[model samples]
Target: MTDIFGVVADATRRELLQVLLERYLAPESATGDISVGELVEKLGLSQPTVSKHLKVLRDSGLVAVREVGQHRYYRLEPGPLDVVEEWLVPFLSVDSLGGGLEQGEASGAFAAWSGVQMPASLRRAGESLQHPSDAGAAVGRAMADATHGTRHRFEEASEAVERKVFDPIRKKLKKD
Candidate 1:
């Protein structure tokens, strides 16, 4: 789906998107909302100019607005971001390269061509960090885990429901 973000990739629209994202990330007031005046001050753009950018942003689904009394507050909408992420998957996948990357070659001829660069120590650290089960691996473990359906370190969920509910309380009580 061609989204507002596709339209928003333009320089002016992107600047507006960045401003909106920043506001959502760090809200200024009780409602954490921003008005056209606030955006004008923050971006140093005129009211109508900011409004024009905002209109494009709003039309593209990159932003959402709410009316409170006489004010209109704008914030980012993350739903379209998911679609963009999915669309980017093929570009992110290494399997598409086929036949796997050859060793030594991974750093020399191939690396030179692909613009890959890394310090020796950093490369060693990365090598040491490889999953034991996947000997000779160099890609990120999170991507490996995802491809293999292995549970990610941060994504662990307790099989025991009661324990899941009580563990946090237990920690708090113990602390008390």
Candidate 2:
């Protein structure tokens, strides 16, 4: 089996994965699974070329396949990508800007939503990004901007749910 690094090293493979995601995983118009022909058309590659990339992705367990008659349908397998995310947490921290975060909260909060625990070393790495100095001001401002944006979106989504879902039920119960 090829390692994920090797499988994703090729730009074509990444593009293939994007094609599968955009076509089959789009929440607005997802059709569930995608076939090799569709990938070839979207990727503008030959069947053999597309199939070769799919084989590598399948071997690395990055893509799951369903056999239906003679056609094979492929979908993304997200489990293996968590390893890549773990490796990336340190880099994603504000280490370069000299201020990371407190208590690995960034990765911890993100991972909590995904139901995965952040590793200890990675958590420490995130905490180590916290630096209190003049230079850290820039990083803090950036973090604040991102946090505000995320919080605003979450609040908006919560309000929408309350209005469109819970409010109607509340009104019905009151009527009853």
Which one wins on lDDT?
2
Compute the lDDT of residue 20 as modeled in candidate 2.
73
lDDT of 1 by residue, 1-176 (tens): 34645665778777777767656654344544678788888778899988888887777677788988888888877677766655444334323233333343343233556766533433555677647655345445534533343232213443353357545755785899
The count of backbone overlaps in candidate 2 is: 1
Model 2: per-residue Cα lDDT over 1-176, one tens digit each:
56777788899999997767555545655645789998998779999999998999998998899999999999888678777755654335423222444454445445667665564544554566656573366446756655555556657986897689767976896899
* Candidate 1 lowest-lDDT run of ten: 150-159
Model 1 residue runs over 4 Å out of place are: 27-32, 95-176
User: lDDT (CA) for every model shown?
Assistant: 0.60, 0.70
Summing lDDT over every window of 10 consecutive residues in candidate 2, give the lowest-scoring window.
Answer: 90-99
What's each prediction's clash count?
1, 1
**TM per candidate:** 0.50, 0.54
